[model samples]
Target: MATIAFASSSSGLLFNKSKETSPRNGASLFHYNGLKPVEAKQFEAKGFISTSVRCKTVKAAVSAPKRETDPKKRVVITGMGLVSVFGSDIDTFYDKLLDGVSGITPIDRFDASEYSVRFAGQIRDFSSTGYIDGKNDRRLDDCWRYCLVAGKRALDDASLTKPVLDTMDKTRVGVLVGSGMGGITAFSSGVEALVQKGYKKITPFFIPYSITNMGSALLAIDTGLMGPNYSISTACATANYCFFSAANHIRRGDADIMVAGGTEAAVTPTGVGGFIACRALSQRNTDPQKASRPWDKNRDGFVIGEGAGVLVMECLEHALKRGANIIAEYLGGAVTCDAHHMTDPRADGLGVSSCISKSLEDAGVSPEEVNYINAHATSTLAGDLAEVNAIKKVFKDTSEIKMNGTKSMTGHGLGAAGGLEAIATIKAINTGWLHPTLNQNDLEGDVTIDTVPNVKKRHQVNVAISNSFGFGGHNSVVVFAPYNL
Candidate 1:
C-alpha cells in the first residue's frame, strides 16, 4: 500500500511526498529513491498535513502558469491597419485616442437632423484610392470597402506586398474580417430601388456586396489568399471573435498568416434609425463629443460609431522565419453568451465575469498579471456599469488594474470596436501609455477601478485584456502581452 501526500496552497494544489508501506511477505519489488521527505512535525507547524514518510521541513514552491513557449503554436501580431474616424493610419488613430480626442460629430453622411440621435462617430471623406479599383469602389458597400483597405494596408505593413507576396505561398494566408451590420448602406439602397423602380432596378451586386461574409471574401480576392476565409457577425464582439478564430487557424496549421479583425460602416440612415428605434443611442446633439461618457452617471446611451480595424496575425515560427516585426503576442482569448437578454447584459455580471476568467485561464495568466483593460464600456446606463461590476468580480484588487473605455472617445464602433480596442491595447503595451476614457465628468460610484478619466496615463503593461460585448449578449475577451523571446 502507498500513501500519496498533497498540500493545498492559496495558489493551487502542491504535491508533496509519497510513502510506501512494507511489502507483504517481506518482498519489495521497487525502490523509489528520488523523493525528498519532509518532517511531519514541521509540516504540522506550517498547517500542511503529512500522510507519508517525512524528514526535514521545506517550504512548498509556488509556480505560476507559463505561457505557450512553443514557437509553432504561439501567435503574434505583426502589423495593424485601421480606417478610423481619427484617420486611416494606426499611429494617428492611437495618438488621437491617447490625447483623449473625441471623434464624434454631427452625422452629416446623411440627413440625421430628423432623428433623435443626430450625431455619431462617423468616418468622413474616406477614400480607398490605393486599395481598390475606382470602378469597384463606386459599387462596393462602405463596410466591404473599409475591410479591403484595412486588410491590404495591414498586409503592406507586414511587408507582404509585391515581391514578398509573390515569393510566399498565398494559399497559406487567410482573411477573417467581420462586420456587425454588414453593408447596411447597400441593403438600404437595394430596398429603396425595389420600392421606387421595382425589381428591374435592383442591381445584380445587391446580394454579393450586402452580406457579412463578403468583406472577408473580397479581401481574399484582392490579396490572392486561399486559406480559411470567413466572417463572424457577433455584433460588437465580431472583431474579437474573428481574431480568436483566425489565430486558431494558424495554431491548427491551417494557415501561416491571417488577416483578421473587424470592419463596420453602419452609420447610414437605416443604421442610425434602427438604434434610435431601440432607444439605444445618445441624444446629446448639443454636444456630440461629450455624448459618449462611459461610467459617467449622466450617460444616456452609447453614441453610434463606424470604422474598420485589421491586424496581421502570424504563427511565431512563421513570423521568425520571415523576420517579421512582432508588435505583440496574442496570448489567448475566450467567448461566452449571457443567454438572458438580447440587447442587454446580465444584471448579475455572471457571463462577463466567467468570460474574463476563462480568457485569463486560456492565456495562461493570472488576475494579478493583468494591469490594463480595454473595456467595451459603450456608455449605456446598464452596459457601462454592468461591465465594471463584471470586471470587479473577476479581479479582486482594483488598485493595480487600470481600465479605459475607447468607446468614450470613438463612440462605440459596433463590430469594429473590438478590433479598434485591440490595437489600442497593444499600443498601450508597446508605448507604456493608456488612453483616457473621455467625458468622464461624474464617475459612477460602482466603478471602483481607475477608469483613466480624461487624460492618458503612462503604464508599463505586463498583460492586457480587451473586452467586447455585443447586442445579442455575446461576450468576448482577448488577452495580449509584450512579445518576449
Candidate 2:
C-alpha cells in the first residue's frame, strides 16, 4: 500500500542518483508508493521512472496547449457613457468629434499664463445635478464626480433602472472604473495645507476621495453593486485594461454585468507643471485649438485633457435575458509592456505589434477584417510615428485599414483616453462615419495610411481596434465589432 511519487534532488533524479549521497548534495527520496532504493532502481531500469513519469511530465510542462473557451459566453457593450469636454451626452460628444472640433482651450480655471503649456481639453460648467448629492459633490474631487455621473448614465443607457437593478442580484454587478492620476487637486491641496496651515486644516474626506479606487467604490455605493469592485491604473492604458479585465469577469461567470472605464481630473497647476517639466506638452500658445495636431510635421506634444468614459458591459446571454439595448460586441483585447523605456515607447515597435496581433487572435479575427483603427497618436513626434510603424507591421497593406487619430480633436485624456476613444470606436461602428484627424496639413514622414485628415468620411466599419499606450511602456489594444444576432 505504498504511494508512488517523484522527488527531485540537488544532483539529479532520485532514482538516477546514489541513495547514499550527502544531504547537502541530495536526499534519498521515495516514490508515492514508498518504493525502497532497490525497488526504485528496478522500476527505473524497467522505464517506469523515466518514460512513464518524468518524460511525460516534462513534455506536458513544455508544450501545453492554451485552453479555448466557448465563444457563446462572449461579452457585449449594452451602453456607453462619457463626461467629456464636449458634454455628458454621448451623441453630443460623437457629433463634436465628427465636426473636427477641438476641445483644447486655454487653462482658465487657474492662472496658467506663465506656464509653458497653458491649454487643455478642459470641461467647463459641468453639473452633476441628479447623479450626486450636493454635499458630497462639493466634498469629492472632479474625478469622483465624473465617475458617479458617467456610471449612472451608462446604467441608464443600458435601461438598468434602480427598480430593475433591485429586482436582479446586486452581487452579480461589478464596477471597475480606473484613473491614472486620481484627485490631483485634492492631493495638491492637502499637501499645501500640510505645509502652510497644518495637518488639522486638511479635510477628513481627503483620503477617501484622493485614492484611485474611490471612483469605483463610489460607483458601487451609488448603485448598490456588491460584486467585484476595483480600479486599474496603467497611465493612459487604464481604460482599455479595465475593459479587458471586466469582460473576462463576465466571461468567467464571476459577474453578469460590469461597469468599466476610466476617469481623470489632472488639469490642476501641479498636473500642468509636471508635464511641462517633462517637455511633454505643446507650446502652441497662439492657437490652442490647433495645438494638438497628431500626425502633422509641426506637432509638438499632446494637449492634456480631463474626463471620464464608462461602458455598461454584460455577457450576451445576460444582456438578452435582461432585454438590454445592445450597442457593440466586445470581441477581445490584449495588454503588453515594452520593458524597454520608462517614458518613451520602444523604437522597434515590437510591443505594439505583438499587442495588436494578440488582440486579433483573442477576437478570432483576421488582419483584413479590421477596417478601422482608433489610433493612439498623441501628437508627440516620436509616439505618433512609432504607433504608425507598429500598425504597418500588423496590417501590411494598410489600404484596407483606415486609421484615424481621435486624440487630434480630443487631445490626450491620459487615463481616460482609451475609454473616450473606445466610445468613439463603438460610435463609428454604429454610425457609418469616421472622424478626421484635425490639422494634418503636412504629413510628418512617409505616412501612407489615409488618416481621414481634416474632414469626416462616410465609411462602413465592420471590425475596429482602439489602441492606447501609456508613459510607463504599457500598451493595450481592444477589438470591437458590430453586434449582430
Candidate 3:
C-alpha cells in the first residue's frame, strides 16, 4: 500500500518525494475514505484536514472521533524503527541474528588503544547524511541524530505522515524517546573543541543537542506533537521504561497517540572509559566478531552497542476508530526495581521476576499464552543468568517457551533494546519466524533455558514478551500479543 500527499495553500508550498501531484499555492483538502493516512503535509496554510488511507495489511494513522472503545482493548504496534550495528529494518536485523552475527568491532570512531575494551558494537556504516541535511546535521548531537533518524524511519515504515495529524488532535500526540546516556559524543567533541580553539569555538547548540530530551523534543516539534512529552534514562532499560510510560499515558487517557523508544550513540571516549572503569564491557579486541556470546559458557562481558528504536503507540479507542493497522497488541507492561543494588540485580532475581509476573497479570494474560520471549540476555555472566532465572520463574509450562536475544545482533542496544526488541517480536509474530540468539553455541552457568540458534525458524507464535533490565536494578517487561480484532 502506497499513498502520498501534496497540499498547497494560498501562501507557500512544500512537498515530499512521495507526492504524486503538485497543487497551486492554495489549501488542498485531503479526504481519506478509510483511515486518513498521509506521509507529509505540504501546504500554504495550516488547518486540520481529515484524509485517510487504509493499509490493507497494516493500519495507518489516527482517524475520526473515536467512538466507544475498551480501556483494556489490546494495543497494537502500527509502526517500528531501529538503528543498530545490524541493518536498520527487521529483515536485515533478523538475518544477522539468525546467523549469529556479532556487532562488536574495534573502536574506529576514536583511538581505543588506551582503553581496556577497545571493541564495541558501534554503528559503523550509517552516513547520517541521507537522514539529516548537512547544515542541520552539525547541530544535532550523535544520540539525537540517531533518535531523529530512527523516529522518522518508524513513521515512514508505518506509512504515516504529518498531514495525518489533522485526523487526530495534535495536543493528544506525545513523544518519549529515552537515551540511556545521551550526548556523550557531544560532550567529548565539545571538550575537544574547547581545548583546540577556546570556549568560543564551541557551538551554542551543544548543551541542547547533548541532553537526551533534545532528541525527543525535536521529534515532537518536528511532527507537531505535544502530549506527555518526557524522556527516561534508566541505562540499559531505558526503552522498556519509555514504552511502559507511554502505555500508561494512553491507558490513562493522557494522550491518544504517542511515540516511544530509545536511542544511544555513546561510542566515545567517556562512554568507553566509563564502562571499562566499571569492568562492564567486553575486552575481546582480537576477536571482536565473537565477543557477545549470550548463553555461552565462555562469555566475558557485554559488547556495547549504539542505536535507537522507536514505536508509535495509540490509545485503543483512537487506534480502533482510525482502523489503524494493528501489527501486535501490547497487552500490558510493568516496571520494578531490586532496591538491592545500584549496579547489579539480586542473585535471586526477585525484582525481575516480580516485574515479569506483574506485567503478565496486568495484561490479564496467562504466562502459558506467551509464545516467544525477547530476553535481556547481554551475555554478561551474572546479568544473563539472572534474567533467565526471572523468566523461568514467571511463566507456566516453561519447557515449551521459545526465547531469543536480539542483542546478539544489535549488540546491547542499551536503552534502545526495549523498543528494538519490540520490532523483532512484531516481525517474529507477523512473519511467523523466531530469530536466533546469535553467538550462542553452548548454554552456560546454572541456566537451563532453551536458546533459539543459528538461523530463522518459522513458528506460529501469538504473544511475545520483551524484557529489559537496566543499571540501578531497574527492570521492565513489555507484553505484545498478535493483533486480533
Candidate 4:
C-alpha cells in the first residue's frame, strides 16, 4: 500500500507521495491521495492507531488561485441625485428625512377640494432654467424636465464635466432613467385637445414627450452618450428595476458607466383622479401631513408623490481610473413577479419573500448579516403587513434588524420610490443614522420588527436592503454596502 503525504496552508492543500509522513496538529492526514477518512471506524479498520501520519517533513509545491491585481469589476455608485418635494440636493433630501419633515401637503397645483384625497407630495419651486430651453421646457412634460435635471445633477455630482465626458469613450456611457406614468400631464392634455377642438390642436411634441423612453432618450442626446439607452416602467418598482438592469449592463461589459434611476410627474388632475378612482390613495384629507403612516394601526393608503431620483453608476475599475468619488458599492439586486394580482400584493407573500431571499443570495450575504431595511411599506393595510410578513419569513429574529419606511416622509413616489429610498439606504450607511418611519404611533400587532418610529436612531449599518414593490405584483430589492476602498 502506498501512502500520500498531505499538508495544508492558507493557499491550499498540498499532496505528495512519500514513505515518510509528517502531519501538523489539527491537519487531516490521509492514507491515499484525494481520499478523506470519514469515520473513526474506517480508520480502525485500516489499522491506523493515530489520526496523524508519520513521515519526513517535505515542502510540497502546489498551484493556488491567483489573487487579482485589482479587485474584480464591481458596480459602484459615484453620485446620487434626487428631486424630492423637500428638494433636489441629496443632502437636503436626507436632512429633511432625518429631521422627520413631511413633504405631503394639499395638492395646490389644482383645486382638489372636491376630491376625497386632496393632498400629495408635490414638488414646488422646481425650475429647469439652465437644463432646458424655455420653449422646449414648455413643450416637454414635467417628467422629462425632472429626469433631465436629476440626471445632469448626478453627472455633476460625479464630477463628470463636458470635457471629462468628451475625453472618455462616449459609446461606453448610457442612460436608463424610467418613469411609471410618463408625461401623464401631456397625454391628458392631448386627449382633451382632441376631444374639445380638433386634431390640429394637438402639439407636435405630444408623442415625443408622452412616451416612457423619452426621458432616457433625451438624457442620452443631452450627454452625447451613444451606448445602451432605454426605460423600464415597472410601476413603483421602476427605479430598482433600472438599477438592477444598469448594474447588469456594467457587469456584462456593455457599458462602463450608466445613468440609472426613475422619474415621475403624475400629479396632474387626471393622475390624482386615476388613483382616487382605484382607491389606492389615502383619504385622510383633514391631516395631509400625517396621511402617509407606514406600519401604523390607522394607516389608509399611500400618498402620491412626484419627483425623480438618479444615480451615477460606474464600474469600480473605471471609477478608480478616473479618480471619481465612490459613494457606495451596489452589492446586488433581484426582481420577481407575483403573477397573482394586478393591483394587490399576494396574500401569502411568496413573491416578495422569494425576491428578498434571491437578492440576499445575489449580494452574497446572509440574512443575519443584513442589519437595515428601507421597507416598501406604503401605509396601506394589506401592502404594509404583507411586506412585514415576507420579511419575517426571510429573517428569523427581527430584533437585530431595524427597518424604516421613507414613504412616511416622501410619500410614495411610485416609479421613483426605489431610487429615492436607495439613496436613503446609502446615506444611512455613510452617516450611521437611520431615519424614522414617521407617524407610527400605534404599531401593527403582527409586525414585531422595530420600525424606528418617529425618530432617528444612531446605529452602524454594515449591510442594507432597499425594497420596492409595484402594481402588477412587481417585486424588486437592491442591496447596498459601504465601499471599503
Evaluated with lDDT, which candidate comes out highest? 1
Model 1: colliding residue pairs: 38-55
lDDT of 4 by residue, 138-249 (tens): 7889898999999999999999878899998989999999989999988998999999999999988778889999999998998899889999999889999999999889
Alpha carbon lDDT of each predicted model: 0.80, 0.80, 0.71, 0.80
TM-score of each: 0.87, 0.85, 0.82, 0.85
The C-alpha stretches of model 1 lying farther than 4 A from their native spots are: 1-61
Q: Give the TM-score of candidate 4.
A: 0.85
Candidate 3 wrong stretches, greater than 4 Å: 1-73, 192-202
Model 1, 191-236: lDDT tens per residue?
A: 9999999999999988888899999999888878898988999988
Model 4 C-alpha RMSD vs. true structure (Å) is 18.6
Tell me how far the alpha carbon of residue 457 in candidate 1 is from the true structure, in angstroms, after superposition.
0.7
Deviation of model 4 at 156, angstroms: 0.4
lDDT of 4: 0.80
What are the candidates' C-alpha RMSDs?
A: 16.7, 16.9, 18.6, 18.6
The model with the greater TM-score, 2 or 3, is: 2
Tens digit of lDDT per residue, candidate 3, span 55-80?
12121223322212374444567788
Q: What is the lDDT of candidate 3?
A: 0.71
